[model samples]
Target: MKRLMKTTIAFILMLMLTVLPACTMSDSAKDLNSSAKNEVGKSGESITLRLTLWGAPNEISVYKKVIANFEAKNPNVKVELQSIPTDYDTKLTTMVAGNDEPDVAMMESGSIALPLAEEGKFLNLQTFLEKDPDLSLDSLVPNITYSSEVGNIIGIAPGPESYALFYNEDAFKDAGLTAPPSKVSEAWTWEEFVEVAKQLTLDNKGRNAADPEFDPKNIKQYGVNIGTFWGAYSNFIYSNGGDFISADGKTFALNQPEAVEALQKLADLVNVHHVAPSPVQAKNIPATNVALQTRKVAMVVDGQWNSSSLADTNTNFNVGVLPVMKEPVSTVVCGMFSIFKSTEHPEESWELVKALIDPEGSIDMLTYGTWMPSLKTWYTEDELVSKWTDNLKSRPSGYKDAVIDVMLNNSHQTPTGYVKNFNKIMDVVTPALDKVWLGQQTAQEAMDAIADKAQAQVKGRRDLE
Candidate 1:
């Protein structure tokens, strides 16, 4: 059920763990870069570069100020900004088809960057990036920076990102248990995590899931929400030591024992253990902030982007690193600033891309917890980390350990599913998930039935090796 459809529930581009549509760069790195070239030095000529991105009006307003600041710093180069209010992919596709694409585009990470790069519609940025002294692409999250590539580096995003366990501290206090792990070393094993969750869940009759008399039907507070629409359940697949696709990007692993077991455990939370809400029952639950704030749920496994939503809640919640099954891990998701091949102002555009992704471009947004920095400096350099994570208005408790550490060390990008062929695979597998969620079959049973179709789709993809 991870990102099966076009409509996004929480964060629009939140469905994927990783994508690889573009070709890898050759070792010599000579032909990896496109013919496009501009000098390394700052441009002295007066010019304008058309920039395009999608966002709500307020986000656009915030970016407009960012653009204004960029323009002030580069007085000679002006920016013509275009905002796509809706159907960003459709509009972007249309623009590309019409040969009217923007010079620098804020492409949604998985969906747009990979396919467009595959089509050779974007310039290879490896050469230009090699000259940078101030910004090191190596310092960025490889899952994000490495997202767009076809024979060369073509895309880069400014932040490191990951999903985490957000739990109510007061609820943990009431449960008489220590809060979940803050650092990866202390992360819980699957059984330990489930035991803790069972303790936190309470029925209206004042019973927990551990009680044999506990009722699943009249539950008042659930221990966790697997984030039915937020793609949280998929992480269990990774945690259990399996993947949606193989390293060669040529096979699906949904039917593997590890993944099947992982899926069963997730389902058991609802169907068997009755510690978490059913996918259908999750509809009654409020947003992440409201659910945790109101104590309707004890914990939520969700993305870092959700902190902004929780800032107003008086829940006194704190974040914890994800639990380990076989190993500590997390699913990484972030968008990138990619350059369109049609852009005439490649040098000037690269400058803008760097400015936007760097901490200074949108420090306030990062500080507010909507995003985390992609630059290594944000994690390694104390002053840079403080610039984003140390703030009165933002920075939930234990965030440095939960969000920052996990992203830099433990996270991996979900395979983009053979050049956006994921939807095709999910189209066939989601029905199986629906049945499993409804208790029509066991996780292995559902996956076993779908194995032929999934492997067929995986092996049939033209994009994968």
Candidate 2:
């Protein structure tokens, strides 16, 4: 049931996450950029670059501003913005089959971009990126950069967003517990987190899960809601020193002992400890902010984009580092900005890609809080971090240590970013994991049953392997 709810929410949030915020820095564009405009025609005919992206109307509206800015700087170029809000992947396929692919596209990493890049559909921007005076592949965060071949850059994530532990401060006070650790080194251990949960989880008769007379069936407020989705759960698998796929990308590894142990601990929270709500019970819970505000659950594991949603709630909520099993780990997930091989104006399209991804170009996006900067300097340099986080209501005080520090020092991009045929592999793996969430099978039993089928789809890791 958690999977079912998350599937629906993921579709909407994933779409929300994929929308790229356009640059509004018109006055300083020339001062900030050193690259010469690659004019389309020597004869002065206007070159129109077709740009395709998926987003809601609100997101699309901001993107149009970005396009307008690009056009302002390069007066000879015209950009036709094609916003596909629904059936994006299917429509992109239709465009490909019809030989009408857009000049540039914002691609969902695993589902659309990597598979197409392997088939030679997207342009290799390696040479362009290397020669660019303003930015290089090294300018971005290492985890968000990708290449199908060594030194052959294919696509780069336009922004970065990762998973973190969000909790209600008021709930913590009620339980007489301190807030979760803000720094990675101070993160709680698995046992410590469970013990805290037991104290917070309450029954109808005002008994905690730790109470001898506590009744699981009468649970009124759960201590936590652990996401069963891969994006949320995979952090734990990696923290336990395991992975869904091997680093070489040729093996299915979720059946390994380390992975099994991490997953079992999460299951134990639901079935054994009863500190977490069961799938059926969770169906009634609202969104993350509402749940925390209503005190339906004390803590939730979710993406950083929830920061904006959390700001609207009256609850005194804050974020903290996820507990460690062995390593302090979090998963970063984002779509890549890629130029299609079909583009007649690769130079101009590359310019558009660079403009959209530059953090300075999209500062409004960062301030509004659905996105994080894609560049490493944004995390490592205090000046850059302050540019986005300073006095920003959505960014709580602990954000620097809990979100920024962890992303820089202890983050891994989701397997979807690098693993081949990731969507296909998940199709075989998710159903088996569903049984684990349902309490119908142990993590080991469920994974063992499907490992063979999942392994058949393992081709090789595509990104920087």
Candidate 3:
């Protein structure tokens, strides 16, 4: 009887041990969930922060590294990256309207930044910058910084970018030209540039620009490839003393005499001079492919990002960089990061921002040859300038000087203002401008119509404000 009683007690204890563990586990799980809910204010601590940006494959890889580094440093913060193929503005607009905006977004330097800032969606960074002494706003390039600042700095410039002319050296040599212009100050004037372009242009018969039988229709090569995008057009307009919009952002100035003259000059390249491809012809050929691979055009104005793309191509031709117009005027576009007011951990977010844009990190971007550092000090530093020369050995004689001149003296912002619908205005203007390029309407006729429509849209935006 004693043995049986002992066996029964042993069995009961074993059963209790097994059951007790499960009960304890259930309670522990409940406690964990409760703690997480409390910490995250009913949402949960595993909040997924989203960031939206657009870049090439390599840029995506670098961004992923940055995010991974940020995540490893921040164990509690989980970030989700979102990439848009194209039409970033549309994606951003849709997400913002749905109240499903990413925690951070990358935007361009033109009217996009200004309009978004006016919408009050972006958090003002001025307060944060003033409070944080470690983040030296002075370190940034003045022109780029100025462009990124919307009203009172809703964004911080992280990358500085400028446009330069890319020319095919072999093409110039074949045309028997001495050398391409090197300095922005010495950059070929419109008339002089046209002359060089004419000489470089070729037809199937090997007849040069001097040959009367040089076939415009059967031409095998174009003199220049002017990017037809709005940003590209802005350079021509600005150089010709035209403004896209008035200072108030309420009136459209694109239809002014200067603006019309600029558009006419671009049109003349195709219709009158017959040295460039028609709008229809240009549309058929991809801009990058035309400039880099086919070498169909002798010169093209593109940004630093093109270097990476061209380097990956099979083309053996060396590219020479040129400044904007002869007057040495160009626009600088930049990308920036902003911290939102709704962030649960402002301090941590700011730390991430600083890590991503610090001098060392900025130099990493510049080393890739895809971007220019926003920090002004990097321009002259032996380490930074060396990279430019090392990678672009065959750069045109005056290319470096022109880049320095633009960086130091002549860069300008695209005019951000209180009008919230500035991009919408661009949407309308680009298509109308395309009509002029297509020869459907004259430059003045197209600009006049577009100005009337844009002015009404701008007025509506003003009324909303």
Candidate 4:
């Protein structure tokens, strides 16, 4: 009898502990729903908040219309969009250090977003998220929610981004080859890509890279141009089953067999194959949009952001899915609007965050081909997808498959971006990698030289410690 009473009492206590909170949460969520429909401010009240972002003038022009629509939705709120053009990440650091950070700042996923969120500089979004039950992250691509979190969510993404092949159709035609595949299902293999690049590469004497007499120097056109930046190289690293960080996330993985092989391939493009311009010459090439369209380069590895510029210029180009190496994979980028912990109006700032991500609000940026909506409803609900994509002049041919389909199925998170103290780790590793880029040494030799020190920084960096 005593044992039975004790067991019954314990079970009752456990149920109270779990069930009571769930009931409370249900009520809280309901209350928040009610508040959302009502104006938080008094009738006709007004507030102004500074929103920081970085983009070219054309991007800014479109964002202004987005802001106007947001303002119309909440008549009392005025959002001033401030564009930070150069060294955007460093500028954001300065703002945080000076206590002059904007109420809502656009934070790109990866290293930049991670450190700040970990430091508690951004608001703890747990309560905000719990309260706003209507905010759906269901459609957010993989790694987005992870980037937004460091124990607690510090932000919510407005849209997601990924890399894809952007090729000049005229360049391909001139090379006597058809354009590369537009869909991921038909992506070119690394060997096929290199051969195509050779066809497009030409010298002043009109010799292609495939020609035995092709001049290595004084080349008039490169077959392909690959950026050394993270966004571009990462796709190669991942596709080859290599990564810069170890699986445990505590050490450098750049010296691994897979990574070493991948780096060698990148170096080979400039040094051995001569299909791409030299590292020095690459610095002088025009922007990807201009170089591809003007026939200075045949194909370029770049992000989806170039889509808008290409559309606006009416350039003769087509989207190509990323080339496959040992596997089919590519890196993705997601950008979010985060409220600072110092903001006087947390609720109002959240309102802006919503307006940035909501299906209705994000369509302007989405249709322009600069972003993929993070809302699942946008893709799953025809009424929603058509609402934004249809009648949008900026969307390119096969965008539905190349951008949307790939984003949903093919893209993966960047490893270096997620690892702690990654920026410091890269600082040690980049110079060593640069030697490979410049053809001073093979990738294996250069990375092996710096492997120990790079891992040291990853495990016990001074700044991050």
Candidate 5:
């Protein structure tokens, strides 16, 4: 009996020792696994982020190269690039409505960015900028940076985009002119510009605007090709001391006398002066390529992106760039990349954005001539300016100065509210403006109709407040 009790006690003690040690080992393993997962979550050690943008084939190629380089340097984070089509706003709207928003997206200036920012779809970048002192806000051009501040900076301007006049040097010489004005500060007033354009306009018999036989009906070439796009038209309107919307953002001011005068002048170019292509003719050309390449028009106002198109073609004419309206006033279209509030990795998304707008990246874009650098310091520095001018052996005389003026002065933005509903209202205004251009309706009648309809739509939107 004594032997039996002793055996039982020994067995119980042995079992307790074995089980306790095994249970401790199991607990330790679980702790190690939990710690590793926490570290991964904190560091974003192995994660993929989605970036969305719209670009042409070459533009996408360039972006891909930049992304590859970024990925190599950032081993723990990977980026999947999704190339959205040019109709990005439509695509984005659908995606957002479906609750499948991209982690990051490139937004257009004026209407697209303002409305999206108001919807609270984008992450507030002010918080990130505040945390990173190395990301200098001062480096960006003041106006460009100011445009990005939708209720305090929802994004950063990734590229410096601006509008300038593109002129055909051969056409100028054909008109017996010395050269198109290059400096915006020294640019000709509207009257002076019209006079030069009139000289460039020719009839089949080679008669000029001053000649009585220079028949508008039998014209061989237009002196200018003013874009009929809403954004382009706004440049003219704003430069003439007119505005589409009031400063308070509540009312449409486009029916004012100044605004009417600006519209009349634009119409006169087609109807009275017979120097610019009619809106119908401009639309039929599809892109500006035919007008510029064939030298059918002497001058046209276009954005920096047109540089690539000009370079890609075999046209031998020297290209010159100037600011808007030949007046000191101009408007700039500044676009940026915004991270959505639903982004899974806000920190990583910002890092990618920083890489894209870094000084080195800015230099690459500037060298391409499709974009101006957004950095203020780079604009003043001789080295940066020389990159575009000194190397361009084909550049027309005074071309560099004109581009520089566009960079320095005459860069402004439409009021925030105007930008918010840009496309919606443009749809209304374009057809009405077209009617005026087609002679179906007078400028006053067309503008009055546009003002009434636009005001109603805008008022309804504001009432949602």
Candidate 6:
């Protein structure tokens, strides 16, 4: 009789524990729904939203100003900013695992956000995006969309950064060479670019790379210092009419002739041509602005965001389109802002997300050259383009053709946007690339050795979903 009573009591206690919180959650949800329908801040009921971001102190300061602007407009909404400067993905994942995710968060699309979206952890923002008069997928730059599933957008890049050639104007003048092309139509072919690079490369004795007296062992200044990693070289591969994976995404394609050739040229710039530094040599190289200001490198192939620092450091630099192997192409990429599905106040959270992505709300980022506008109208409309670039210290002359036009017409979204398990595939592929960059192996040899392993991890593109 006592055992039966204890069992009944234990079962009843278990039910109470489970059912009570659920009932409380339901009541809270109802309150949130009522608050949302009544137009959130209109009801005079204050709400706090948690937002996560990963950036340095300067970036955080900029974000705080933006957040303050958002708060000024909506007195009832208060935001708690959580800035994680390092190990962001690991910490964000831990928060999600503990069911303590922030209402809205910034994440690298291909690395963290898209993978989580695949597990239904993020809210499907399709309806919100479609209904919002101010935002639309159609209005965004082509190929920058982030969706693992068709017709569903879980997150989006607020702004994009694209690759361009940043050259020291004085260096060009000193070398007695014309500036690199600013227009896409006039972009240099790979061969033409290399010939120019050879002229610009100089040893301590003042002999250029093209001269017989030039000493690779005592290079005083490099002609170019193009990043040899996936972020930079992938654009070259695409320009060569090849890609890291096949169109169907089933096969690894880096071993193809065109892709191999592009990578080989990059390697030869160090090993044979001696116009650029090897990875070891680059370790001592400073940031783009510092490197150029000190004449450490005559030209740098880097992201547009470098314009901010170039301006800040007062470097006399000019922008140009990247040299093409076959086709003119630049890589456009940025992180994403997303809302977690676990939030009890999704509507309020969405309000914060909207403000975060709104161009006007973050105008400082655009004007200061840390980011480019993601909206098509910003690039197409002269008035809007002037708002960000005209009279700005960061945007030099030719920015319209070199950056805005190229971004609008000649950009390709980074492969991370559509390639599933891309990070994993790269794990198998990057070491092999390192060998090519270090001159330990030929591009063909390195890629061939990793072909089977990389393909095994491909799984396919996310669009297949």
Q: Please tell me which predicted candidate would have the highest lDDT against the true structure.
A: 6
User: Cα deviation of 50 in candidate 3 (Å)?
Assistant: 4.2
lDDT-wise, the better of 1 and 3 is 1
Pitting candidate 2 against candidate 3, the one with the higher TM-score is 2
Q: Write candidate 4's Cα lDDT for 318-414 as tens digits.
A: 8778788887776876667788888887888887877777656656577777777777667667787777667665555656667777777777775
The TM-score obtained by model 5 is: 0.83
Q: Which pairs clash in the backbone of model 2?
A: none
Worst ten in a row by lDDT for model 1? 31-40
Pairs in steric clash, model 6? none
Clashing pairs in 4: none
- Listed in order, each prediction's TM-score against the native is 0.86, 0.89, 0.78, 0.83, 0.83, 0.90
lDDT of 1 at 127: 72
The residue ranges of model 3 lying beyond 4 angstroms of the native Cα positions read: 1-50, 71-80, 84-98, 108-116, 145-151, 248-250, 314-326, 362-365, 387-389, 392-399, 415-420, 459-465
lDDT string, candidate 5, 1-465, tens digits: 447645755565456557667656456556555665575656646778888888767667767877887888787888899898768888878888899888877877554666777777888877777788667666666555533334367667766666667777778766678676676656777887788889988878888776778988776777877767655666778777777766556666667777777877888888888888786566554355557678677777776666656766665445444434434655666667788889888988888888776656555555665666666766688876676556552334555666656666666663432344656666677788887777677767887877877776553222122
Candidate 1 residues lying further than 4 Å off, grouped into runs, are 1-43, 147-151, 391-393, 417-420, 459-465
What TM-score number comes out for model 1? 0.86
The all-Cα superposition gives candidate 6 an RMSD in Å to the true structure of 7.8
Give the distance in Å from residue 211's predicted Cα in candidate 4 to where it truly belongs: 1.7
lDDT of 5: 0.68
Please give the lDDT score at residue 155 for candidate 2. 80
How are the candidates ranked when ordered by lDDT, highest leading? 6, 2, 4, 1, 5, 3
Q: Give the Å error, residue 135, model 6.
A: 1.2
Whole-model lDDT, model 6: 0.86
- Candidate 1 CA-lDDT value: 0.76
Error of 5 at 63 (Å): 1.0
Candidate 4 structure, TM-score to reference:
0.83
Which portions of model 5 show Cα errors greater than 4 Å? 1-44, 110-112, 145-150, 283-286, 316-327, 362-364, 393-397, 414-418, 459-465
